[model samples]
Target chain A: MKRWLPSSLLSGMLFVLWLLLNQSLDPAHLLLGTVLAVVAPLLARTLMQPIGYPRLAKPIILIRLLGMALVEIVHSAITVSRLILFPKPDGMNSQFIKIPLDLRNPYGLALLSCLINSTPGTVWVEILPNRHELVLHVFDLHSEQWWVDTIKTRYEKPIIDIFHEEVHKENPP
Target chain B: MNEMETIPLWAAALLVSLLILGGSIILIGALGLMRLPDFYQRIHGPAITVTLGAGCVLIASMLYFTVLQSRLVLHELLITVFVLMTAPIVSMLIIRAAVYRDLRARKRDSGVESGGIYRFPEQE
Candidate 1:
């Protein structure tokens, strides 16, 4: 099973996406979707990094994180709308800040970046190469420490828990 | 169209409200791009459009079709998924390019000197 389905999660998503795109439950579509799902991942496997598959140690945490992110997105959308409609006389305080990251799992970092960027007021600019710090640009700067704490506690902590990178670090293969 | 009659009143109302909400949100996002003073802040404008705005319109489309056809029409989900997956990457690249350009010119807001991610040519 491992040999054929290198990433079962990805394969399943691809299969479902194929069927949905076709908008059909026909047997022919099912057969074609299955074949494409199996083949596409295999072909793309060479491009993937050697990092071990991300194990969802706690799936519930991931779901909760997504839910929280959705709420944040809506909340920030309103905040941003207000900011745009009613401009500050002195101009908005937009600035770049760096947050140190403890979650070393590439997948976790990717998800964090996506989540941050998806929110209206924040963007992930870059990661410091020498240091495992994320450079983020904030549209409005209220307090530097607050943003750092929020990113660390609210976002990074849950991702770290879900990925369980500490276990990987402890027992390296 | 005859198909328009197939949708229930509640569904049609919901669809219209969602579309209006989404369009207003997108309009605000576009206004941000023009109103924001700097590039970094400007990029954030479209983030709203990509996330909640697009999401609203897509959900409305899905509901409209599902109600019209009397079936589960979810291909719009593919658009949502693809947009969510790719929007960040595009913004990330654009921001990086802008940073590199600003850093080369020794601009104040590049944050390269403070960020310590990439060394400025003067430092090198």
Candidate 2:
């Protein structure tokens, strides 16, 4: 079962999604959704990177983290909206700064980008393949070092801990 | 529309407020897009606002459906999760592409060297 269902969560989601979209629990729909759910992950396994079981290991931490994210997202949106409404046509400062990345896991990096983009006033500009340097653009550039520290400590550490646990478990050192 | 009366007064009020909040957030974001300076700055408007706006709207919808049908209706969660997952990826792509174009346009002089460092084009 484990070998066949490399991403059981994804497959389960597909099954639920199929049923929800069709809005039916008829035997036909169930059978079709089950077949698709079981086979889709297996066929798509080659294209998917094996990010070992992205699950909520610590429920408390996950809840707290989500709460923080929701608050931050709302606050940032309000701040950006204010800036937009108050400022003249070109009153904002925008520039890219490169920060050193401590989290090297692919899933963690992906999450970092997602969080950064989800927050207003910051965008992930680029990252070098060879180097662990991540470039990001911010709407307000009060202090470059401040952004770097905040990002590394607030966002990167938790993400690294979350995803790196998988890496740690996979390849015990 | 008929479900309006079926929904409790408080629930209906809450739903309307949530929907209003979501729509206003999206509207503010649109306003930002029109007013902000550059492509990069403007992108923030839609990217962030849409996430929260859609989130609020989805929550309202979930509340609504649950009340109406008297069962936990959660197709809204699927849409919320999808938007949250994809919005950031889309933002990253847009920013990266914008920055690349900006660099290229700004540095038409240096013969295609990115910030004095030559990056080999992707083989793939």
**How large is the interface RMSD of candidate 1?**
2.7
State the lDDT of candidate 1 residue by residue for A19-83, as single tens digits: 99889999999999999889988888887746645567888999999999999999999999899
lDDT of 2 at A124: 85
- Index of the highest-lDDT prediction: 1
Tens-digit per-residue lDDT, B1-124, candidate 1: 9879878999989999999999999999999899777677789899889998999999999999899889999999999999999999999999889878877677655455456554332243
Model 2 gets an lDDT of 0.76
TM-score of 2: 0.84
Candidate 2 lDDT over residue span A100-170, tens digit each: 88887776677778778888888886686566688777887889899989998888877766664577666
Q: Estimate each model's TM-score.
A: 0.91, 0.84
Which candidate should be chosen as best, given TM-score against the real structure? 1
Cα distance off (Å), candidate 2, residue A62? 4.2
